[model samples]
Target: MPVIAVLVLDGVPGHQLTAPGLAFGTAARHHPPVAYDVRICTAPGFEATGGLASFRVETPWGLDGLADLDDTDTVLLPGHERFRDPPPPDVVAALRAAAARGCRIGAVGTGTFTLAATGLLDGRRAATSRRNTAELARLHPRIDVDPEGSVVADGPFHSAAGVLGGIDLCLDLITLDHGMAVAIETERQLFLQLHDPTTPATTCAAYTPPGSSLAPTTTWMEANLRHPLTLDDIAAHAGLGARHLTRRFHAETGLTPLQYLLRARIQRAQWLLERTEDPVERIAALTGLGTPANLRRHFQRQTGTTPTTYRTAFRTFVTNLTPRE
Candidate 1:
């Protein structure tokens, strides 16, 4: 089993601190017989002060309780309220030592700041919340900060964009360790819809009010994703002129008709990739992308990876997870 050490600091966001446990723990439960052991660790004098508001949190383990870096598989750093300030020297030293010992390090939200301060991210790509991207880049000029990605992994170091992005990062780690099936099952248990990491949060919002003007047309588009769809077809289905439909769709969905269609198609393709073993050619045809080449181009642009690579990685992970009879 992998041992995960979550380092807690003063003013740490409660959600970030708990997210790793929830993700890994839930995944382990679904997989049967636990696969990971997670523990919260802090320095001897550490006292928990909640972020966003002042509240108290208590933990059972101190820094002395941590296993040697070689024994610990990963160390998670959760973002604290005072992210602008450098972490205590002891914590920084510990993290540096852990990295040197070949332990994987993960930073959640502004926890990237703490990780960057150790110079481990000096020449590596990292991610932080979009709101703090400029500051992160300005502070660490040698580090490549990706503003658009929700989670970024370069070697043994992984960084997540925001509080919720911590979940994405943990789920990704679960996928890497177990497989797509386990990750998808964990997501279902958590009541989360699997989303493409590269897609912006606003673009993934599926909020359509009951009486919204675009609801009916949007419904039709989903049902016809396998067909060769055109803007005119959407307009005709909605009983409106093409020009009028475009305007209303934009007003209601915050996306043009074509943009919404593309998003829908991408989502459908992701589902097929996760749930079926169909070849790229068949998947492309099923999702109305026309051909394998088109799917590769668009899927790479949307998710930052090729279809074959995605399938191989996910399937291989899952295959390793199957228990022996």
Candidate 2:
């Protein structure tokens, strides 16, 4: 059984990820030869979108899982609300490596834009949501955008229109892997399972962060990344004791509060480096890194390169994607 690694980022839509997995699972049940070990892999330093109704997913795998993958396996990127932002360097690098290794890459809705950021779909005909087709074409002119294609397949790159088209894309992938009969059977099983009354509603309590959850607290931290915050300040915001907050925060995010804050600041710096022409000094101040030296030190330690170097490479990549006069 090959692994179907579904890469989800911040603000990942609930349905986009679930549909493909359910479809593949149903297909595998019908045809054992096409079994897939589906894994929901979260991006490094994954954070929630901080909506009142937003829930968290505890992903068993991270980007490190992609470092060693079977070429026969597939990597599917579901639509994330943050798709407009340039993907983190680690994500871009992982996808680039997977593409080079001959992995089948698929994207849905805004996910198409994220894949395009990798430049893998630059010259390929891809489809996204009907509304975003023109914006995608405007951003990545090298791509052959399909304004009306609900599900477009160009070489190894398969794309879907939106959340609704996700199942179609997965069935198409099943069709590519097996025969049409298996795909048809998979769809049938899926529909039956959906309408099955015996299938009980799964409790989301495990996924829901507790009332004391550090989710809202983390959102607060991100909002005040430029401010000078302390452990006591964070604990106060969360209404937990300092030591209690540390333990809870680490348990949830795998990082201590201060550690998470520093990393968040570094990610903020990365965002500024890629999206804006801000100098290191201003970025450092804005991210609460204090000074250029402090920013360079932490940035280099975390990113393995300097801030200016990262920005220059990003600009060069974007420039190459642009059509010149």
Each candidate structure's TM-score, on Cα atoms with residue i matched to residue i, is 0.59, 0.58
Alpha-carbon lDDT, every model: 0.74, 0.77
In terms of lDDT, model 1 sits at 0.74
lDDT string for model 2 (120-177, tens) is 9987899887789999999999999999847899988999886453877898998787
Among these predicted structures, which one has the highest TM-score?
1
RMSD of every candidate to native, in Å, equals: 17.8, 20.9
What TM-score would candidate 1 get against the native?
0.59
Say which candidate scores most in lDDT: 2
Residue 86, model 1, lDDT: 77
lDDT of 1 by residue, 40-157 (tens): 8875445665745566656677664454657448888888777888777877888888888888899988889989998999999999877889999999999999987478999999
Segments in model 2 whose C-alpha atoms lie over 4 Å from true places: 49-52, 193-325
Off by over 4 Å in 1: 43-45, 52-54, 163-165, 192-325
Q: What lDDT score goes with residue 213 in model 1?
A: 72
Cα displacement (angstroms), candidate 2, residue 168, comes to 0.8
